[model samples]
Target: MRPILLSGHERALTQVKFSKEGDLIFSVSKDHTVCAWYSANGERFGTYKGHVGALWTVDVDPHTRLLATGGADNTMRLWEVQTGKLLKTWDYLTSIKRVEFSEDGKQLLGVTEKRTGQLSHIVVYDIDSNPEAEQPDEPTLRIIVDELPRVTVAGFSFLSQYIVSGHEDGSVSQWDAKTGELITNVFSHDADMQVTDLQWSADRTYFLTASKDKQAKLHDARSMEVLKTYVADTPLNSAAITPDPQSYVILGGGQAAMDVTTTSARQGKFEARFYHKVFEEEIGRVRGHFGPLNYVAVDPTGKCYCSGGEDGYVRVHHFDPPYFDFKFEVEREAASQSRM
Candidate 1:
């Protein structure tokens, strides 16, 4: 499939996200800007340019009406998605590393980096979903990460029953969304390898995590159990699960750019790898980026998938008919036997 290349960011991309309907793609970069694009043609919709420092994360509300972003500017800001108006800003002690809207969009969460003597924190606020409604200044909940390692990524789980977070020390923590109480913590990934990304399934009953340990794992959100594991040769930066009709997981990462100059692209492993979710086997891989891929996000409708690379481009790829038709030998045999 021919990929639509979006060269909207000047610097390396930090994260990429698709709207609920998969009609739009939102991307944030270390260039201190966020860009919105039409998923169909990769046409630039607009840019949000208020952050003074590098942006690390971006997420849109379910309705695609509000945008939440966090950055090194030491602030988490909200913007009206349609008009690109700055709606609210919540100042913090350090760079905000990740931002996300809950399942309902009535609440928002941001994870602050532990830096300059400041402790990492997971802060949540009551979101006014309506673009015109004034957002509150104070957070409804604040979680300080004093005992464990610093937080690297976090998000709300199914029904907003739990708030899940990945830590810098390769551990994952589950918290009560309403009471801000810690439920359990599990060191699933290799120790000392930071958990780089956390992404949920379509139903949010389970989630996937990528780590610097050269591995990605699927975990049960409620029980905190490691359900499955996908191993890779290089450290992983991001992992995403495809929605219905496709049982595959996307893994994106490679060796650092500085360390890969002497090696070719093939040896560098700068490609997005697709693995069979149920079988835990690699199905295929897509190569394009010269530098390491920082993040990968799948279209909610399972029509296409996109990857943000350190090469400063977002590649949107639509699946071909062959992609939908290909099946494992076991699957083919099952289908044939069931027909009798």
Candidate 2:
């Protein structure tokens, strides 16, 4: 597969996501702005601007008509996707690290870092609430887990009844979204290894996590048991699963914060690795970025995926027909051998 490079951000990209309808791509960057583009051809649509500080994350609602963004300005804001008009803003005491919409689009979740640095909180807002009505002083649910290390990534479950979070100390926790009650906590990696990203499978039966510990793991979403582990030579920053039935995992990462001063330095440490989900075999790597890749997202159809990096570039990679042909052949061979 060849990557179509999309360049515009003046600083590192923090998040990249394809719209639910698969027509547009949206990305947020340390440049303090969010931009939209045509998913098929990489044409720039327009930029969404308002934040006074660097943007950290973004998510689109299930309908793909609204967007949510979190930033160092200590607020999460909602915007209309068509005209880029700011819809609402929820202020916080510190920088917002992540923002996500529930599967139903009726709720929004956000994680923020407090001024004390060690303390973090998760807030869930009722998106279906009347916008014309008086805005509440606080979120519908505020969850403060003092026992957890600082959170790195978080999202709602497929049913939107539970909130799952990954922490700086390599732990994973689940909580009741409505009651703000802790459900379970599991040690996922070695001490001090941060869980950098999390992605759920298309069916929501399993979830994948990437970590600073040089590994990406697949876990059963219900049992919370480790199902498989994919090891890498360098620390992994982001991971995602294709929506295809024969799902393959895509991951990206590198040595932390290497200075890219020369041609060779630019070529090193930024590769998107592919792995077969069932067989756990490495397939291929896509190399292009000059710095560490920070985010990746697979399109809903599973024919392509996109990556954002610390080098301030977004790349969209579409698979060649032969790639899928070869993958299916391997799957068939494995299935036949198992039946014998």
Candidate 3:
């Protein structure tokens, strides 16, 4: 399938997200800029100008009117999506590594990096969707992660009942969303591999985590059980779960840029690999990015998928007819049997 390339960032991209309606894409990069692009033709729509340091993560509200970003500026900022207006900024001691809106967009969550004298923290704030409304200056709840390794990625879970976090030591912890209490913890990935990304399913009932261990694992939100694992040859940086009509997982990673000059580089690891969700077998791949892919985001509408890479470009790809028709032998047989 042909892909639409959006070159909006000057440095390596860290995260990419699609608006709920699937009409717009938001991307953040190490260039310290945030860009908005049209999904249809990859047109540059607008840029949110702030953040002195490199941006690490970005997310849009469900209504598409609000935007949130976290960065090395040691701050998490909110913006008015339509006008590109800066709404509020929350300062922290260290870099803000991740930011996400809750399922209903009623709350926002951010993860801070642990450095020097500062400890990593998972903070939640009640969000007011209206652009003109003054956002709160203080977090509603803050969970100081002193008991575990630094948090690398985190987000809200099903019904906003739980908060899930991935750690630098390759562990996943579940917390009470309202009271900031630790519920349970699981060492889902290999020790010290460092979880790189965490993304939730559409319903938020379960989620996926990608790690530098060269693998991605699926976990039940409520039970904290390891549901499945998808393995790759290269250390993974990102992973995504497609929406309903499609049952697939998208994985992206490769040899880091620092390792490229070592003469041991391979090409296959740079490609985005797709695997069957139920069968746990790789089904296909999309290749183009020359550098390691840092993140992959599937359109909530399931109409397209995109990848942001160390190459400083976001490739948006809409699906082809074969993508919808693909099925395993068992799936085909079961469909034919139903017709009988």
Candidate 4:
């Protein structure tokens, strides 16, 4: 299979997000730039340059043309996607690790690094009414509450009622979206290894989490119980659960550059792994990226999956009939068009 090469940037990419149409790729780089590129031709769509320090993450709203970016500079800025204009900026005074758009796109959720022993807080911003633009005294809903650890909150999801966060403490917590109340914390693993990433299934019934413990865990979102676990060779940095909620593909290896250490050189090539839910085992692993893995997302349909890593490469992978019998029609079209 021929691989489509997206031009590498000067600095390492911190995060990548795809538009709802699956046509464009949004990337946040340590070079302090947020860039949008055509996933097909690798064409540059637009760039936002308001971040003062290394851009840590970028999230796009599904329904509206809005973008949220967080940086090492301890700020989260909201942008108008069409004009690339900065709408508002919130200062947190700590490194902002991840930012996510609520499912309905009405609110923005941000998780910041914890310096002191104080519990980490998830800040919710109301973007609906820009009362600050009209009435300076208008209240902006900023809630500070205890969270799992201030470690990398690599993944987050919000349904119509609740918001869920996956944290470095190897746990996933559900909270009330409207009141910011803690509902429950689901402990999937015994160790404190970072739960690097997570994604909810289409119906919001189940979610998947990847951890530094070299495992990907599936949990029942409703009961908060561990459903299954897939053992990996190295640390699993990020993962994306398929739309079906039955399976998921994980980006294995931490988000660090690969080097030929005596111990690791004897190991093997680093790559991503795919697990089958029904069989409850790892059926396939793709050794495409040479560097440590960063992120993985299965297109809305369950067919094809995309991964980006520290090698500054984004690879879109395709599977044949036995593994994936065209379960995801939308992703199949993308894979067909790109010849992935």
Best by lDDT: 1
Worst 10 residues of 2 by lDDT: 128-137
Candidate 1 per-residue C-alpha lDDT over 257-305 given as tens digits, one digit per residue, 9 for 90 to 100: 6787888877889999999999999999999998899999999999999
- C-alpha RMSD of each candidate structure in angstroms: 1.1, 2.6, 1.2, 5.9
**Candidate 2 on 1-340: residue-level lDDT in tens?**
6788899899999999988777789999999989998888888888888999999999988788788999999989988888887888888888899999888778888999755844799988888533334444468998886888888888887788778889999988888777989888888776789999988886666789999998888887767788988888778999998887646898899877654454364445689998887777788888888888999999877777899999999999887886676656766898789999
Superior by lDDT: candidate 1 or candidate 2: 1
What lDDT score goes with residue 154 in model 4?
Answer: 32
Which 10 consecutive residues of model 4 have the lowest summed lDDT? 130-139
lDDT string for model 3 (1-340, tens) is 8999998788999999999989999999999999999999999889999899999999999999999999999999999999999999999999999999999998999999999889999999999999999899999999999989999999999889999999999999999999999999899999999999999999999999999999999999999999999998899999999998789999999987787556333553788999998888999989888789999999999989999999899999999999989999999998899999
Question: Which one wins by TM-score: 2 or 4?
Answer: 2
Candidate 1: residue 105 Cα off by (Å): 1.0
Name model 2 segments beyond 4 Å from true: 129-137, 258-263, 328-330, 333-340
The deviation in Å at residue 302 for candidate 1 is 0.3
TM-scores, each model vs. reference: 0.98, 0.93, 0.98, 0.83
C-alpha lDDT values of all predictions? 0.95, 0.85, 0.94, 0.68
In order, how many clashes per candidate? 0, 0, 0, 0
Candidate 3 is scored at a TM of 0.98
lDDT of prediction 1: 0.95
Using lDDT, rank the candidates from best to worst: 1, 3, 2, 4
> Which regions of candidate 4 fall more than 4 Å away from where they truly are?
117-119, 129-148, 154-158, 244-247, 254-269, 301-304, 318-323, 326-340
